[model samples]
Every structure is written in structure tokens, then in C-alpha cells.
Target chain A: MTVSIVVVSHSENIADGAAELAAQMAPDVLVLTAGGTADGRIGTSLEKVLAALDHAAGGDGTVILTDLGSAVMTAESALEFAEDPAGVLLADAPLVEGLVAASVAAQGGADVQAVKRAAEAVRGPSQNSGPPPQREVSEGSVTGQGPDFTGDFELINQAGMHARPAAKIAGGLSALDAEVTVNGVDGASMTALMTLAAGKGSVLHVEARGVDAERAVNYVGGLVQAGFGEP
Target chain B: MVLDVNWAVKWLTLCAQAMAEHRVELIELDRAIGDSDHGENMDRGFQAVLDKLAEAPPATPGAALKLAAMTLMSKVGGAAGPLYGTAFLRAAGTMGDAAEIDPAGWAAAVSAARDGIVARGKAEPGDKTMVDAWAPAADAAKAAADTGGPEVLSVLVAAAEAAEAGAVATDPLVARKGRASYLGERSAGHRDPGAASSALILRAAVGAAA
Candidate 1:
């Protein structure tokens, strides 16, 4: 079973909307919402958060994403009061993007820690701008310490490295044993991959290591070649 | 006299009374620098605590505090909910299963509660938040408890008085945290609503002991 997700927000609509948006990308993942007071006011409630945590418990694990200050405090208070805080984690990231990333990771069967990482990764370098993350290997013999496997694929789809494409690549890579980097960014990180902004016809330099190295390369190659089933 | 479960219950009951008595004043203070919900939230939270206490009265002081912590966290519906909840929860942890609290226990409990507030709110003494009141109160309680022939009542009074003074001291300071901080220099000359509520709560502890 995949890890469950809880969205905490001061506005009920915000929590429900964020959960709804995430569920679209991760149909099988459990994304619960704990927003607003029990009286339906605009504030976080510890009881509601506790109830959501209780529901999310006993799954593979649970990752919580919160919006604003009091929501974070309420989530922390719930964690403190929880019967077992072992598998529960609170991600310090923007609520909507973090929830979507976490939900996608969970749907791909990532562990709780990985799910938290995915959520937090949303806050990394802006996806569509900025210089790529510095790679340990230099350009030439970058292959000397090179990835176990490498492949170059052209983006076939009209809309290139957008959120959906990035999510697909990231979701698939997270389940693999390989550590992959796409065009200098962490391959399993959706936001990082989207940062590549490799639009249509752009060549994506894919590299991978670990036991699933070849499979990871083939996975990205297949997705890119297929245009991620998009136009 | 020993501060026992009965004392805890009475303290909470008096807290509810204090909240009711000072609700409008807190609301006015918050209106100057916050969302104006402090009094309403505190009153609602303590009333819920009273209801919970009636539903299942606790046998130990710690148990009573834990109950209060949960209720306030659940019902207060604001930052104060978790802030005060953590404070009470940590204090309860210090009390453990003991039926009564001595001067030292009171000192420890107050300090733990203050630390919990700091951890949860990430506020410092001069932040013009509730920490302004709690920090001095904790120090004063500890100092009173440290003196030879320390009396529990003396420790409680010291905390209450120090907290009251701390609350008063916030009136001229610029807020560095919470909603009041948003106002920048304008926040000065207004008493921090949280500090005021905290002072009231601490004063109620003295009333309960008396």
C-alpha cells in the first residue's frame, strides 16, 4: 500500500480543492483533508487534524502538508498528541504543490520519507527557470564517473516538459532502484525535471545508476518517445 | 496546602470565569492588533474544558491538565489553541501521575509550559507575544521555588504577578511576531492581546490556590 496524505489548511475549500487536484494525478492514493474548525470557521482545528491522522494511520505511512502558520501548529500539535508518531511526517512545503508531489509519489508506492521528500522537493529551484543544479561530474568525462546507463531522447509532444510530463517521469523513477538525473536535475524530482524546461524537440540527457539503471533509462526513453500519451 | 487534582479543576474553572469576565477586554485588545478573536476563542475553549471536566472528572492533576490541553487545542480554533495546548500538554508531562504539586513541581511545570510555548510559537521574550508574559512568569516561579522554605502559594503568586507585569510591559513595545507584527511600528502603544490573556490565565491560577 502507498503512503497516505493529509492536507491541512485554514480554509475548508482550500484543503478540499488541494486534495481534489492531487487526487486527479494519483487516483489510488488516499489524500485526506483536515481544514477549518469543526464549526466551519476559517482556522485550523487540532481535532480535525487528529481525526484525519487517525484515518490515515495504519497505512503504509502518512505524510502531512499544511498551509499557513496556525495550520502548521495544529498539525504539529496533532502529531504530538498522536498515539504513535512513528510513521507520520509533516512536510514544510507549499501546500498545493507539495500535496500534489507527495500524492504522486505515494501513488507510485514511495515510502513515507520519500513522499515527504517529494513534497519538500517542490520548494527546490524554480522548475522553469534558473541555472540547472550543479552536477558533480564535469561535462567531458562526466561519463568517467558517468552514470551506469545514459540515453538521449527528443521531446515528441507539442507541450514539452510541463507538470504532467514531469510528474509521470518522476512517479515512474521513484519506484525504480535507480538514481536518475535528467539534464542535470534529480530525475525522481518532478519539480526539478520540470525546471529543465526542455520544450518540444529538446534533447533530454538522461542518466541512471543502481540496479534499475537500464530500466530507469528505458522508462524515461519510452515515456519521452510516447509523448507521455499527450498530443 | 497541596495543589492536587481538585486544585487543577478549580484553576481551570477559574480560568473559564476569568475568560468570561475579560472577554470584551481581550477582544478590544485584539481589535487593535489582531483578528479580535482572542477573547471569544479563549472563552469557548475554557467552556469546552469545563464541559470535558464535567463529563469525566480526572483523578490526577496531570490528567486534568492533559484533558484541558486537548480540549483547548481542539476548540480554540486559532494559533492560541495550539500555543496554549502545547504549554498545558508539556506542563502535564512534567506533573506525570502525581496527585499533588509541590513548589518545585510548580516551578518545573511552569517552565515546561513556557518552553512548550517557545517551541510551538518560535517566539522569544521580547517578541511582544504571549512569550512576553510566560517567560518572566516561569523565571519568577523558579526563583520563588528555589528560596528556602518555599511555599507553593508564593510561587504561584510570583508567577501571576510577574506575568501581569510582563503583560503591562507589552503596551509600549513593537510586536515582532504574530498578527500584531504585521503592523510594524503601528503595533506599539497597544497591549498584545495574547499577553493580556496569558496574564489573566496566570492570575486565575493564584485565585484557584487561594
Candidate 2:
């Protein structure tokens, strides 16, 4: 069983360092890195990264970790080139976490499919708290959280919480003293979970478990179904 | 005989050539369901890889390849850089300082490359990606190689063709993986960028072998 890693970051130092670290720890583990030369350097296109990753995985599957934003896209693109990409996963998990996952996945007789599923579980985006309360995902591998939640409100508008509705929700949430955590649906981060980039008929989980949990959750919920502010 | 430093260089050159040729078409496909840079990114990366191969010609297949991998990860941007880089590097590792490759050695090297791609990408046969092309291509190439058919040529051609067809097959897929997932139902109509490039690489393989 072989293991490989792909790290994408705009920072050349980061990309180089990370690649070095991965190589040091897992010398046998194939590592391929691609990115700009500096801080302001533009990262490579996600498409090219995908091809490179295919080379890494050979024919089995691979584990990928990204710096931010389209880094995930780049990882996803790599999966496209893999043979059993199901074994491929984007390590949102700490670098160590991803390495451990890859090792275990490789040893456990886990095909790229199993690795892909488990890794995706970690890479899967979080949900957001919003008007509609439901979220849909291909599978339930997504995990992790960012920040906390605050309050809620019954949605009261006709059009519901679209971008236009965001001002009210943001304003209401912003007004609260407490920091709010909004999940899109099914405990995923709709805030930017990649999967939730969709528009219209979207539902948000919208958790407000912090100091103003009840109030914030309710406020956001209300703003969601209520169509922001439009009559 | 399988291949040597010359074989390795030639094979990789072919890969770069294939990727360069098909890079655009792949990017167009990606634009529909993905980030739309597959072609352009790969083109940029392979061009860099070719440059590196020229600057420091490796004496052994393995040494030459490690350098290629380094170039991809460093010079190329986006996903293709790391992925293809890893494949070549890993395949080089399998070659293990070989002066030249015998049939089995070549098979092992290509298999290693395949393994590297699998480890890095983690894609499967169906998700409308290059896996569809790679899996069959690898199998077909190996079968052909054992028969004393053109080892490098058979493998590359098989891998490329299988990969391309696999990309086209993606047209009907709903994309269970990658940025295409963001497109959801909207992604179904397009072929996968990775798969398209996979085909081009196969074409290069055939070209190189001949």
C-alpha cells in the first residue's frame, strides 16, 4: 500500500515546507506540490493540480490538503484524475490528522473509496443557519465547526432569505452582543461549505448555541423564512 | 527491453506533449461543471516540466523523474502540477536507479505511476473523472506489455485513449466529486476535464511509443 499527498498554497514557502515535512515523515509517501512562488503569488489553476495529483496516486487513490478557498477545488480536481479517488480526501483535518488518516486508510485495506468517504467526512463543508431549515449532501462524511452560535427568529417574508434577505439577518445577528454560528442545514456550514454555493430554495441549519443562543437562532430563522425585509 | 533514461525522458516528454495538446479542451469542459482551468493549468505545468527535463537531463529514469516531479510541484500551478509530478516521481521511484527498463521493470514503473496518481487524487472509475481512463488503460497496457508489444507505447496509448473516453463518458454523470458537486444537477451535461486530459496523455503515450 502506497500513500501520497498534495498540498496547495499560494505561499511557495508554505508549499515547499509542507512538501518537505510530508516527505520527511513519510519518505515513501509520494508528495507533489504546486503553487505560486510568494505570498502575493497566484496559485495554479485547480485543473492542473488535478492532473498532478493523478500522477501522485498512480492508480489507487490519494490524500490532499489545501491552503484555502479553491484549494478545495484543486483537491477535488485531483480526485478527478485518481483511479480510486474514493480513497482521495481533502484534509481539512490538521496536517497530522490527514497524514494519519492516509496511513490508516492505506493500511486498513480501505480502498480509495473508503478513504474518500472518510476524508470527505472531514472535508465536507459545515452547514449554515438560515430561513429554510434543511440541508442536502451527497453523503454524511462532512464534519468540523467554526466559531459558535447565538440566536434565532421566525422567518416572516414572502421571498424568504435570499441575498436580499441577508442584510436583515446579518443586521439582526450583528445587533446581538453574542457571536452567532449559523449552519446551513443538516449541521453543515452554509456560510461557505462549498456544497451550499447554490441559490434559491436553500435551507440553513442556523445554530445559535452561544450566549444569545435562543434569541439569535430565532432571529436568524425568522429572517430566513420571512424574506429578509420585503413585504 | 522496456526502457532506459532515454525511455523515461521520451515517455515523460510524450506526457507533457499530450497534456499540452489537450489542455484547452479539458479546461472548457471543466468550466461547465468545475473551476474551468483544467486545460490551461495542465498546459502551463507540463510546459514547465518539459523545460526542467531539458535543463538537467537525468542519467537514470528515477533521477530524471524526481526532478520532473519537483518541477511540477514548484513551477506549475493548481492541481495538475502536484498530481502529474507525483505520478512521475513515484513511477521513477519504482524504476529504482535503473540504467534501462526491462518489460517487468517498465510495467512496475507505470504501475507505480498509476499508484501515485491514485494516492494523490483518490478518484474512482466512475465519478466522471480520469480514473475511468486510467484504470483500463493501465490494465490494457500491462497486458500488452507482457505480450512483448511495445511496452511504453502500448501503455501510454491505452492509458490515454481509455482516459479520454472516460472523460467523454462523464457527460451523463451527475458529478459526485469535485467542484462539479457545487454545480449539482447543473454539472451533468458536461464531460470531465480530468478525464479529457487523461485521453490526451494516452494519445501522447501512443505517439511516444511509435
Candidate 3:
């Protein structure tokens, strides 16, 4: 279980969403996204960013990808901040591109350098490659009825439950006339839990209720695994 | 009373020696969560500073501080580099022109150093890092300055004690921010590297004054 932390000025969704789109087939590796404007909780704290890099290493070396200047400065600081400066690698490759590539390469059991190449491959030519992102799920679709509502699905999005996703998740629940409570979380607040740290690979419960419960559970569970980005 | 020429040399030597020792410890603690270069980087950076400050015709205390800041920034890498660099720069800014600093001037320099850290770090007390030690130590230095004591060492002792206490207080904290916070549960076991180095810096500062 190796993890890499990628940061961009734009929403992390594009990369994670891209990964989720690709995962329609891959389905094995988990790429975690945290910190960005898309997630309001994110800020340019070199110290905080370094913490994420150290965590990802898991004893093996961890590769870090950051967007532009301050992000680069923050990244450089992380290189200096780690216990074995050699253990934390600051990628010369683009963040989203690198992450998109690493997501697949890592799953294929490629070496760290292979993952780095994957990242470089995805670096959208001169950036500005796609539209910001369309909605992931609509309300009518989320509330589609089938069976009894039993479980909950969590938003494992890195930026926390910020406006877009929260609204998508909440509106779906609202249309269903279901009694939904976001648990193991601050209940639709900005501090949506991203780490999933029951020590990673652990089960976390996000509660939703009423008529739409069944679909919400499956969708949210799927979303958490997809790293919560639009397909 | 007053520091003799030997006393001045002792202060400079003490600051460099303590920084070298603390930088290594800082790296060990940082290994739990951070990049772990605080010790090697600062030690390397400050040694460069000492080389420059040994300039011919030597400088006044304020000029010496400014030279130190420039050397650290140019030589060191990481958050500590810029922040410490700014601290000495600010301390020099506050020094004006003085052959020797009285207790009040020392307090002013400490305050300037604190301001530099706050500005560079943008961190509050609970961030589980350097600010925790720096903020209280600055307060203690200011309070001691008001004592009107004949010995400047009184202010030095007061500030150093406060920083040391602040560093110890970090032991049980679940760090909410900074590199250590990524450890989550793992970060809890060690003392904060930043706080420890901060205490050492203050101890060195006081030792120089004493």
C-alpha cells in the first residue's frame, strides 16, 4: 500500500475524476487527493504538505507532486523537511499529469520511476486542457427508487465536503425525502474526512436514510473508492 | 554588568555551537513526520553565517545579525531557512546603532525575532511547532526587560526558561497543523522538533548574554 500526495491550484477532482473514469477497468489501486481551492480546507502550508508526503512514504520513498511557484516552494521545503531528505522525492513532473499516470502505473506494479513517467505523460499539453467539470450525479438519478435504504456512502474527496460534491450528495438525499445524516464526518461541513485512517483500507460509515438509501449507499461507496471525482 | 570583549566572543560561539547540536536533534524528531533537514540545514546554514561574520574589522551586533540572516537564506533550504533568515534580519532592523545592547534592547530584539517567526510561519500557538516556544519566550524577555536589573543575564535566563517550558508542554499535544500532524497517531509519540530547536536557540541566546 503505497500512496502519493498530489496538489494543484484547481480542484483535485479533475485528476481523481480522471482516475475514477479510468478505474472503470483498473479498480485496484487507491490514489488519495487532498488540499486545493476545490477543497476549502486546503491551504499553502509547507508544514502540512510535508506531513502528507511523509505519511505516503510508508517507509518506502514517497513521490510528491505540486503545482507551480508557491506550491513548488512548499514542495522544496518538504524535500528538506523529511527525516531522510532522500526518502521524499519532489517530482519534476506535472501534478495532475503525474498523478493520473501514477494511478495506473502503480496498480500495474510498476517501479516508482514508471509511476513518475505516467505522471509526465498525463501533463495535459500547456495545461488548460479540459472544461472545469460537469456535475457527477443529478438529484432525480440519485433518488431513483428500488429497495429499502440500509447503509451510507462516504465522500472520501480530498478537499473535504465543499460546495459542489456536498450539494450533489445532499440534493440527491433531499429529493428522496430521506432522513440523511453525514456521520464519521462533521455532517456536510467543510471538514469532510479524507484520510479514512482507521489505518487506511478500513471501513468507514457515512449514514443516509429514507427511500433513496439503497442507491445512495452503493453510489457513495463507489465514490469513496473512486476518490470522489466526477466521471 | 557589562560584557567584555571575551564575553562578546563567547556569545557568538555559544549561538553557533547550540545551533549545531539542536539541528541534529531537530532532524531526528522530524523523521517521525517531516523532511528531517532542520538540523543539517540549519547547522550548515549557520556555519556559513559564522564564516561571514568573522569579517575583518568585525561588525556591530546589529550588522552581525543581518549578515547571519543573509547567509542562512542563501545557504539553507526549507521553511527554517527563510524564517530564521527573516528573524535575524528583523532583529538587526530593530537594533539601530549600538555597540552593546542593554536589557531593553535585548527584549526588543527578541520581540523582533518573534514577529519574524509569526510573519514567516503564519502559525498560532497550537500549531505544535516553533511558535509555541517563541511566543512565550518573547513575552518573558519583555517582562524581564522591565526589571531594571544591573545584569542583562537576568533577561536572558527568564526568556530561556520560558522557551524550555513551552517546548516541554508540546509533549502530549495532538498536533493540529504542520508536518507532524500527518503522523496522525504516530506524531503523538515524539516531542515537537520545532519546539525543541526553538528552546535550544533561546538557551543559546541567553548563554551568549550571560
Candidate 4:
């Protein structure tokens, strides 16, 4: 079974809509929504969140995405009262983007922690002001000290690097033991990959490091060559 | 007056009464810097607490507080729901199966409640949040409890007074947490609805004993 997801939002529409959007990308994963109060108010309810957590307890694990400050508090309060709090985690990421990334990761069979990371990774460098300087990779560095694997593949899909393709590559790569980058952006970040705006026929330069480096490079290459299974 | 299950029940009943009486005032306070639902949420939450208490009366003070915690968290539809719910839950945890609370036990329970609010909201004292009232009240209860006497009324009064003062103190401070923080400097010159409600709840404890 895959990891489950819970979306908490002040507005019922937001929670339901977010879960619905995420489900489209990861139909196999369970995405639950605990939004609004029991009396049909525009705020979150701990009871609803706790009930959602109870339902999600049957899965491998549960990750929560909250919309606002009080929604976060309500989710935490639910965890405090949950029967199995340890198996559930709260991801500090934007609701819609994080839910989508987390659902994709869970669909790809990533474990709980990896799923959380995939969700958080959506907040890439641009969002994090003054990110730590990256380790420089000189041009034409092909030695053992350089990247374990690297490849360039031209996008052939009519949709190019869209949400689905980015999600697919990011989701699959998140489960691997590698640090991969596509066009200088974090490869495991769907938002980062999509930021490239790499259209049809635009080449994608991939770099990888770690034990799954070769697998990571081949994974992206295969998806690109297949046009991400799209027209 | 013994701080027992009866006292707990009375305290919660008074809290519900106070919420109903001060609902509009709280709504106006919240409207200035928050979403303007604190009064309605707290009133509904405590009403639910009353219903639960009547349906299944708890045997101990802790059990009563625990029931309130669950009820408030479920019925209150705003940030106050979780914040106050967690405070009551942690306080209940401290009380455990005990039927009555001594002065020291009361102090510890209040402290536990404050810590839970801090842990859940991640707010510190002077953040223009409920923690402002809770922190000082915890401190006052602890001090009063340590006075080497069994004056339970004094301890309750001390907490209530300190909490009231804390609520007043929020009137001049710009909010550093919660939705009010969005207003930045504009949040000052207004009382924090959470702090105001916290004071009212603590004051109700005194009324229960009196």
C-alpha cells in the first residue's frame, strides 16, 4: 500500500479541490480532505482532522498538508489525540503544490520520508532566499571526481516538460539513492524541473551523483526518449 | 472549596456562560486584527462541552477537562479551537485520574496547559497571543501554590488576576504571531481576542470556587 495524504484547509472548497487535483496525478494514492468545521463554517476542525487521520491509519503512513496557520494548529492538535501519531507527519509546504508532489511521490512507491522530502522539495532555491552556495561543477569535468553520471536528452513530447512529465521524473527519482539535477535545478523537485520551461525539442542536461547515479541518468533519458509516454 | 470534579464542571459551565455573555465583544476585538469569529467559535465550543458533560459526566476533574478539550477542539471552528483544546488536553493529562487537585497540582496543571499552548502555537510571551495570558497565569499560580498554605481560592484568584493583567498588556503590543501578524504595526492599539478569552476562562475558575 502507498502512503496516504491528508489536506487541511480553512475553506472546505480549498481542501476538497486540492485533494481532487492531487488525485488526478496519483490516482492510486489516497488523498483525504479535512476541511472546514462540522457546522459548515470557514475554519478547520480538529475532529475532522482526527477522523481523517483515523481513516488514513490503515495506509503505509500519512502526510498532512495544511493551508494556513490555524489549519496547521488544528492538524497538530489532531496528531496529539491520534491513536497512532508516530506514523503520521506534517509537511511544511504550500498546500496545492506540496500535495501534488507528495501524491506523485507516494504513487511512485516512495517511502514516507521520501514522500515528505518530495513534497518539501517543491520549495526550491528561488523560494529559499540566500540558499547555500552549490558545489561548483566545472565545464567538461568527466573524471571520477566529477558527476557519477550525466546525460542530455531533447524533449520530444508535444507537451514537453509539463506538470505530468516533471512529476513523473521527480517522483521516480525521489525513490532512488541519488542527487540528481536537471538544467542546474533539483531533479527531484517537480516545480524546479517545470521552472526550466523546456519546450519540445529543447535539450535537458541531467547530472547525477551517488550510488543510483547511473540509474537516475537512464531514468530521465528513457522517459524523455519515450516522450514521457505522451503524444 | 475543593477543587474536584464538581468544581471542574462548574468552571466549564461558567466558561460557557462567559463566552455567551462576551461573544459580541470578542467578535469586535477579533474583527480588528483577526477573522472576527473567535467569539462565535468559543461560544459554540463551550456549548458543545456543556452538552458532552451533561451526556456523560466525568468522574474526576482531569476527566472533565479532557472531555472539554475534545469537545472544544471539535466544535470550535477557528485557531482558538486547537489552541484552547490543546491547553485543556495537556492540563487534563497532568491531572490524570486524580479526583481532586491540591494547590500544587492546580499550579502544575496550569503550567502544563501553558506549555501545550506554547508548543502548539509556537508563540512566546508578548506575541499578542493567548500565551501572553497563559504564561503569566501559570507563573502566578505557581507562585501562589508555593506559599506553603492550602488557600486554593487565593491560587485561583492569583491566576485570574495575572491573566487579566496579561490580557490588558496585549493592548499596546503589535502582534508577532497568528493572523494578526499580517497587519504588522497595525495590530497594536487593539486587544488580542485570544488573550481576552483566556482571561475570561481563568476568571471563571475563580467564580466556580467562589
By summed lDDT, which 10 consecutive residues of candidate 3 chain A come out lowest?
Answer: A186-195
Work out the iRMS of candidate 4.
Answer: 0.7
Among residues 3 or more apart in sequence or in different chains, the pairs in candidate 4 whose N, CA or C atoms overlap within 3 Å are none
TM-score of each: 0.92, 0.52, 0.49, 0.94
What tens-digit string does per-residue lDDT give for candidate 1 at B1-210? 779999999999999999999999999999999889889999999999999999999999999999999999999998999999999999999999999999999999999999999999999999899999999999999999999364699999999999999999999999988888889999999999998999998899899999
Ranking by TM-score: 4, 1, 2, 3
What value of lDDT does candidate 4 attain over all alpha carbons? 0.92
lDDT of 2 by residue, A103-125 (tens): 33333334443443333443334
A124 Cα displacement, candidate 1 (Å): 1.2
What digit string (tens of lDDT, one per residue) describes model 2 on residues B1-210?
346677667867887777776667677787787767677767766777678888888889788788877776655565556666676777778878768765566557667767766766666767765666666666766776677654455555555665566667878888766667667888888887776776676566456557
Local lDDT at B54 for model 3: 69
**What is the clash count of model 3?**
9
Better of 1 and 2 by TM-score: 1
DockQ of 3: 0.02
Winner on lDDT between 1 and 2 is: 1
Q: All candidates: CA RMSD in angstroms? A: 3.9, 14.0, 15.0, 3.6
Q: Compose the digit string of candidate 4's lDDT tens values, residues A70-119.
A: 99999988887789988899988999999999999899888887788778
Could you tell me the TM-score of chain B in model 4?
0.99
- Candidate 1, overall lDDT? 0.91
Native contacts recovered, in order, as a fraction for each?
0.83, 0.20, 0.00, 1.00
